[model samples]
Target: MFCKAFRVKSHTALKSSDRKKLRGDISSTFPSLTTEKLAELMPPKEDLTIAKVFVHKGDAVSIYVHNRNPIIFELARNFYPTVYTLWRHPDLLPVFTTWPPVFERMSGGADLMLPGILMSSFGLPEVQQGTLCAITLVGNRAPVAIGVATMSTKDMLASGMKGKGFNILHTYKDQLWAYGDESCPPNIPPEEIEVAPSANLEEGYLDSESPAYITELENLHLEEVSATVQQESGEIKLSTETFQEEKAEIPYVENCNTSLQETMDDLLHQCFFHALKYKVKKSDLPLLTSAFLRNFLFACCPEGQQVDIKKSSYKKLSKFLQAMQQRNILQVKELSKGVESIVEIQWKHPDVISFVAPETVLPLETCETSDGGRKQPYQPPEILSLYGINAKMLPLFQASGHRKGDLLTANDVRSVIITYVKTNELVHSDNKNFVTVDPVICDCLLNASEKHDLLLLKWDDLVTRCLERMQPSHRVAFPGSSPVVRKGNIEAIDISVAQRGSNKKVTIIKNLELYGLDPVSVGSLLQQRVQASFSCTVLPGTKDRVQVQIQGNQVSQTGKLLLEHFKIPRKYINGLDLAGKAGKKK
Candidate 1:
């Protein structure tokens, strides 16, 4: 089962001799399979060199076709050796039939009950007690579960179809099924069959063409049948046809429109009601507001959609809960002036009880796109050779076997320092956190002011000084593009203060695209964080580069937001010094 851990005991390559023996075993186990069919399923000898056979501790043997694609898993110790993939293959559907309601349960590792079986007019297939059989859903002929029959068809009929009929070994979505490529069972239309006979008839009795005699015999059996038998098997008989009819009768609910034409209030309301009726449980009521929203409300959101309170019409979870309370859908309890918790839920509210959640189509964010296409995968920013090691920083790299003028990335600089300290035994013996600095290190790496402070320095300070010394030699080198010709140039984020009118000042930020952030989202988030008016405007000279302009002196707040939240490096942000100087000027 996927819910539990499955451990693989050993993995080995099958030798030529081993392959020959395995083929013999397979042939004997599956007599119906032809040599050509086996070859088509498995790779050739050349590809077999990379193939690995994994033996799981549970006595399951998995053979990977070309070391990557898991083709088959066999139960070596079963009486009639079982292969899990046979159920998945379309060519092997005539084996069995299972009820549709138990499909989800069987996939989740439940045994198949006799009542879940859909007996044809001819009755259950004749098989031995331990014979391996494939179990398929009612409407779909393709097998979705694999199991061994627990009792013979005759024994099952004598005892009545009430107990566990099959001991399921493996099913769809189980751990073994997840080994190979991800796949779903193929869809097949249900086959129509005559109603099952009321009384047990001899095998081949249904094949007889004497319609008048068969009808007369059926009427006599129905008259002799007791009410107890009808009462006992009534539900099982109805489940076969009534369940499917009910599902077919339910109308398909259309997906709600999430485009800009739909207001945020309407979208939130639709999603909230859907979550209340379908997702939230009565057992989880009387929960803290924060926990309820984070665990229940947010988790109930459709895939690819994120819940942001700021995006809601109410702009806060508390306000939204209050509105729901007013509508008699929920009741909230306040712990303090601003803190609240959900106390009770009106589960039977007319709007919630009757609402049917529709299938999710597109996320709200993607619905606003002009083309209505799914959002593309995120591509990380291009790697750049920002700096070359100078003479002052040469020894640090030289100690780590790198020469002067060698291009060093941010990661390389940290590695060189760590290597030099470990090699020179410069770390303080008592406290490994502190590194002992010598004159050679001080002259080349440390600042003139920091040198006099102490010979001993923290690990962070040493790294900071090393980077500051190497900053002057910075050069931009975009990966997958032309090499850098010019040196000592680095892309810096532009931040500036402007006098709008009178005494008011606006802080403008640009070059955010270089860090791979959408300008619109950044502007909206900034507006919410600072409680200030913010707008995104396309810069004049650039193609699509936009700048975020927030009201008032928000330069410092903008810097902190970028550094703490977006994780942009501090060195890249320019004009932060102007924020403090402007304050001082006033």
Candidate 2:
């Protein structure tokens, strides 16, 4: 039977007596059981047969087929212990040593059995079993952050297994409930959006809004004119503020350019898109205080430190870059690869700078055997693997030294690796070559296979290109951290504004639909409209325009006097139509 989406209560806590009974049942199954050997205890082979599969979603990441053991999930909770086990095993140190073991396995089409869970606490989310759904976590690359999706489930019921293998393939035809952190609009499930993880993921199997339907929304150029308004005096005014985020005009620094630049750009773009969802503005960016075209040049020597490209600053950023270049690799090499170290990242973005310093890092590469490939196997990460079950043996065959160790299934490996690559430095650094677009001019050069107006990037190209870029770096360095960002909820506003002096009305803010408004830009954001409107809920058709009054000096001057003079009439407009047109602009 295939899996079916079901909404069980998050608080499915077992009673004290019931918990005791499960514990007792466990001891009966394996009489020699102790807390140490908990993970090592597998259920009866018969119990694991294809009776049914119940996968959980809505945590940091979605669990496609968490069928290994109910207790394994119970113990692992929301944290993913499997990764650490495969990355570096202590007693089984001879097995494998590396970060993000899952990416490798997924790429190779292998599956992660219960025996391979990692326990080294990397803040890898616990494979949680909550009620909400998650975005799909397939095809990610060395993903630092886990993404969840609402299921392809029509409804939340265990009874509706469509048929066979993983139930993710079966579509519910309708959204179950909103999945993920974003409060998906009511009635619309998060899964309904079909988050095509990264630019590389292929289009999903589920049917969704057609090209024309989506294009119609984009072409409207809704964001261009935040809103339109008509005054009581029959005067018209439109004024919409635009936040022009300067694109990265930096030259590719040849081999000197690390995926680091791409990483920074993709990350910033995430911040941009996320902010736009809340209406964050360009002026708010801390670094872009230098916005003039004349001031937009890249300064490798931002502080004129005259970086030797050889020196190691106290900063982790320096160590990270230097490691990629070999200087720090020599340093990390000098230290016993056995001793794990924590690297704290102090990165500065266009906006406020933040810190990401993970507490534990297993030196998998350093924990090598002297005989090159002759090391014993199974060195699991510390966070996973109870009962000393070495995660390495999950592999169908012994790992060839020429290959990376088994951390996750091949598909898992691919998803984690590719998503990381896309979200990191792969696409953004060479966006001009791979992605050519001029939003203002309405020009694009996309060579997607599909013939919809704009080229849609499919999974294969997105992943392959990302992998192609990573192939070079994978040869040079170990895996890097996966920093993640997601869009939050959006708010509604009844913004209104008008202009000053005579009759030049503010058209930008007049009767417009703002789909993605950055949250940070609203406090002092100027919107002068003759009249503005706000909708309780964005419904299709009918009164697309909400109502509002004039604001600022213009409200009294232009808003009031213009209608009296011109005898003009007020008119309402369909803002949604504008949004679609702009998105599909040729």
Maximum-TM-score candidate: 1
Which parts of model 1 are misplaced by more than 4 Å? 1-13, 43-69, 76-94, 187-586
Candidate 2's residue-wise lDDT over 458-530, tens digit each?
Answer: 4465434333322121111112313222122112222333354775433223222222111111111112111
What lDDT is reached at residue 178 by model 1?
A: 50
RMSD (CA, Å), candidate 1 to true, equals: 22.4
Q: After superposition, how far is residue 150 of candidate 2 from its true place, in Å?
A: 34
Pairs with steric clashes in candidate 1: none
* Candidate 2 stretches greater than 4 Å from native: 7-10, 39-586
lDDT string, candidate 1, 136-213, tens digits: 655455566777888888887876676667887666655555543334554544455565663433221121112343
